[model samples]
Target: MKSRWLVNLALLLVVAGIVAFLYLKPQEHEETDAVHEVSNLKLADFDRVSIEFPAKAPVVFEKKDGFWYLVQPYAARADQVTVQRIVSIVAAQSHEKLPADDPARFGLDNPRLKIKLNNEEFVFGLYNPVTSEQYVAYKDAVYLLSGLYSETASTQLLEMLDKNPLKPGEEIAGFDFSRLEQWQEVRLQLDKGEDGKWQVSVQNAKPSQDDINEWFDGYWTKIRALSVEPYTPDRRAGYPTFSLKLKDGKQVHFEKLQESPQLILGRPDEGMRYTFPADIGFTMLNPPVGLGK
Candidate 1:
């Protein structure tokens, strides 16, 4: 009788262990199952992005040498933050996924916005009134994603432009004031000497080291334009040219497009036009002069 009782107790303990394991096993799956991926691609995997809206021009961006550039609607440097924000859609997560059969129910039949990351296309549909999450269609599946993704891609093309005329990481080595009228009759050429001191071609134009450094570091290097537009030069018009030499042995040329209400400088090679307030523009075009600050 005692032997029979021991067998029954052992069977009860074994059953409890199996029950506990079964209960804990589903919890592990629940943790992983809760996260549903909308796209398998990461943000870095995308080399190009195309955004389209209803009744408007489509904007396109391409990554080159680890830097993003606006390739369509005109070529110019891209705002890195904005481009990264738009690219983040590929990393979005979905809480629910539905069949693409009833696309009209989710407004996928006539998507409000369409964005393409490389060859993968994502179409934005109507928002869920309860959650405010947007429905996006990719491949044969429809996913509910954050509305921020759609809002980011629906921006004006101008907002996508980098306000700075110069590319990131470009080091200025010198300035060529030969095209623009310099002090007196002397056209100035300024370059960084081997010892890292700024050297001017003409002796009479020597300014204090502090003043020169301030203009180069505190001003020109930190220059930000009020706005930018696609540059289209008129063949009949004469444009004054200015140039900036980079430490990388590349020279960037700029054409003075306007000088009135607002000063406009056009980078012909980049097809970009940078506009600045008259006072600021004057400061950028003219360097500091004299020995005292």
Candidate 2:
């Protein structure tokens, strides 16, 4: 009888373990066939963009040779980060559907912001006061997407310009300067000694290594343009006073323009000129007088 009772207890424990296993199992998320994507098109497939805001003319951006360029208002370089952010947010999913009994009531008639990715266009409308979601009209469907989409797509033309002038392709090794300070001509060369110490030389004299390093680092790695202007073909006059040579054998030439300009730097190869303060030239081109002075 005791042996029979022990067998019955073992069976009860096995059943309890089975029940506990079922209870502790993780259930899969429900899958649905319905798609509520804000943008049916992929961002990679879009080669051009046209953005319009209420009471403002549309600003168009075109991608050429894998680089984004502004094609409207003024032809210039486009900020890739700003453009991609808008495309990524719109490409996301939105499941919330809001009532659209009156188009005018939800700002659908004239969307506050409109974005056309390639051939397809989307309109951004009012924000729901209670839920704080935004209304968007795309492909004959009005969606109540997160308000974050509206905020991202709203961008200004000037804000989308690339602040950095040249798409310099290589790490800078060193640079050459002629008539840098109106009287001084310098040719800087950076090389590592057998001991792996960096040394910079100007002509036959070795100037301050710290000053040369600081100039090169700031000019190449950290310089930002004040503005970029469209290029017009004309006599360039002469070679650049300041020339930056990359490690990859590509040389970037710059020519200063006009008198007393806050910004000046022109690149004829890309056909788009960039500008920085006139004082920057003075700061960068002024070399150290003598080492250990």
Candidate 3:
């Protein structure tokens, strides 16, 4: 009976060993096998990107002075986050890769979209029904990548536009609110003093340095618009205009387009309209006065 019990124990140990080995071996194999990335190109190295879709003009972006700018479909500042998403295709990885010898089988013969990062071009084709991955042809090979790459490339031009009212890295030195009805009499301007501190033009209203800085840096400097679109030229003229003077001696002018439901500010020079929530919009024009006391 003891011999029989020992034999049963040995069989159980052997079964446990087999289960452990079977579970760990596949993990070891997966670790050794490196998945292939779609392209060898690095994001920082490629400064130019051009995305072309079927029956639509190609949109292009160029990096200048460490900032991305939309170079096609009318020039404007490109949203950094959106551009990064489109450019990230270069680093995309794929489990399956095949030769580009037969392009039609994967729909590469007539690609749905083409994205060029500098000189390296990636052609997007049909989606794989089984895996639901997109077929992309780059260089001599075709790769299966997530459909997100194609979706980001297909984003509308306006959606890609930067929503910030001011240019990236621009510092506001002062605001000229002389044209605004409420501030016209006071000639309200928030300008930097000779000591490099912020001061308001209103004589009766005295706000602390911290109060001014909070409004400038915490609010105006970091404010982002809800949406941005091309400005319409036919909009009613003589709208209240305000200008922000930057530290570099450049002024960005904004015309108040709407007030009640939402506040819309139009930059005629850039031909862009910036929409903002009405509550926050009023504070932009009206600074903190006597609040510091």
Best-performing candidate as measured by TM-score: 3
* TM-score of every prediction relative to native: 0.79, 0.67, 0.84
**Which clashing pairs does model 2 show?**
none
Whole-model lDDT per candidate: 0.84, 0.69, 0.88
In model 2, the worst 10-residue window by lDDT is 183-192
Report the lDDT tens digits of candidate 3 across residue range 67-103.
8999898899999999999999989999988999999
Off by over 4 Å in 3: 1-33, 194-196, 232-236, 291-293
Where model 2 places Cα greater than 4 Å from the true spot, the runs are: 1-36, 54-56, 99-102, 146-154, 168-171, 182-201, 207-211, 226-240, 257-263, 268-282, 287-292
Model 2 agreement with the true structure over 1-293: per-residue lDDT tens digits: 99999999999999999999999999888987465776656778878888888887778888888878889877778888888877775577767655556778789897788888887877788888987888888776788777766576565566678877657244555555554444344454454344534565544565665765666567756767777656764564763455666667777776656425564667776566676677775555554535444
Deviation (Å) of 140 in candidate 3: 0.9
Instruction: State the RMSD for candidate 1.
Output: 8.8
TM-score of 3: 0.84
Model 1: per-residue lDDT, tens digit, 1-293? 99999999999999999999988885544455465788788888988999988888889999999999998877789989999998887788887888999999999888998999999999999999998999999999998888888887877778778988888887889988777754335677788877878888776665766778888886688878899888676657777778888999999888889877898999887778999999888878777756232
RMSD (CA, Å), candidate 2 to true, equals 7.6
